[model samples]
Target: MVETLKSWRKRWLSCGDTENLFRDNPSNQMQGVMQLKATNSGMPMKVAQRIDVSKFMSYIKVSRTQLNHIKRLKQSGDGIQTKHVSRVIGGLDKSHVKPYGALLEDEQRRLREHWLEMSCNDLPAAFEVLRERKVLMEKSIKLLGLELQQKNVSVLRKVRCDLSFNSFS
Candidate 1:
């Protein structure tokens, strides 16, 4: 019993008693990415925030692969395999794609740039371009609303119609 206790103590000390007791430290620590300096009275101040494009690209690649897999599964009529689909979807959900939200912003910025380059007389033509590209969907209903507002026709009246059958009378 004494020998066993001694052996246990030796093992504990050799392994560092608190090592496994603590949670694993996050790999992406801010200090490693950013340089901090002490301001007045020893307060740490962040100098800059850096964006690692390669990391972002890796995330994009993973998301694209998952999306392609889902699409292929759908096309092949093997969608009944819910486990694979769920795993892919879940992985995508946890990915950085949703958090970034920059894709739509970039598209909108490009469209705005294209619109601004055109003359006032070309406003309709610009809208036509957007429509042709299928970029103007229900999400852009406000644009349609503005167009409708500018027209002399009453949108509400056009939508409302009476249906009646006189055969019974």
Candidate 2:
């Protein structure tokens, strides 16, 4: 058991942890990529590939600390303002940034980057906007159809009334 633990520690230190973890956990890998992009907006994946893992880890540590502080304050019934949460989560990207900054091969990095670009313009917000727009368009079309149906019903009622009066006369 001790030897297994030691081997795992060594593997983690040598930067083998990320591949082993992310290979099976696509959700975690995606979160890491999202956090990287959030922290450094408009940063190309090629640039992200060159990021210093130690520095990235340091930033994640600090950001996580700040977030914990905010969480503690909120739990203690302290009047933690939105500014505090935003400062840690939005400004630091602490909420989304996962600890998976190991170096990847060029081909892997390129493939991930290409997938991100093709699917979402490199940001999830773009996909969200498209989805929302589609929903709104569908709603509007349905509403218009309902309005037309109502108008036809009213006209039919009026025509029936006229035909009855003429037949009686």
Candidate 3:
């Protein structure tokens, strides 16, 4: 019985070339490879990947005020919901069913107008503006769950930068 158990254990533990296991299953194989790489490097498992919000905003032409509203929402300890965040940041103007959609749409229109009028010569500054806008959008999404309308208004009152920077240098 002892010898039989030992033999079974060795067979189960052996890392042999099992072509059918991974080769036949693409997703499983990729997962196996990722697990192997992660373990070998002693890296912590990454729960979420970093999104390049700037690139996404540029593609969608999301406005700065819209971004600021999102940020204010997030900072007030409102948990960001993925659906609303996606809608606001990605330019999918879905009816939110909540009262906030009308207010958000009004602000978004102003931002669109602002973007149309602005021109920047400095690439880095322009990139920063885009980056900041993305940050605000992300934060706003985070805030959506935490604050009431009055709280949202108070939180948003503070983010009063022009967003239009004329670089002297």
Query: Whose TM-score is greatest here?
Result: 2
Models sorted by lDDT, best on top: 2, 3, 1
At residue 163, give the lDDT of candidate 2: 100
What's each prediction's TM-score?
Answer: 0.23, 0.29, 0.22
Q: Estimate the Cα RMSD of every predicted model relative to the unseen true structure.
A: 19.7, 26.6, 28.3
User: Whole-model lDDT, candidate 2?
Assistant: 0.69
Worst 10 residues of 3 by lDDT: 160-169
Instruction: List runs of model 1 lying over 4 Å from the truth.
Output: 1-62, 80-82, 89-93, 97-103, 110-169
lDDT (Cα, tens digit) per residue for candidate 2, span 1-169? 3544675587678775585732666786577667765777755565444356445552233456776887786887768887876766565543444454432344489888899787776467777899999999999999999999999999999999999999999
Cα deviation at 23, candidate 2, in Å, is 80
Candidate-wise lDDT, in order? 0.59, 0.69, 0.61
Q: How far in Å is the alpha carbon of 118 misplaced in model 2?
A: 8.3
Residue 40 lDDT in model 2? 74
lDDT (10s digit) by residue, model 1, range 1-169:
3544675477677675566532334453343223332223376666544354423543233567878878888888655487777677675557555323365566689888887766555777878888876754764887888887867356554444222233334
- Itemize residue pairs with steric clashes in candidate 2: none
Model 2 off-target regions past 4 Å? 1-123
Across 65-96, the per-residue lDDT of candidate 3 in tens digits comes to 76886787678686777766775665345423
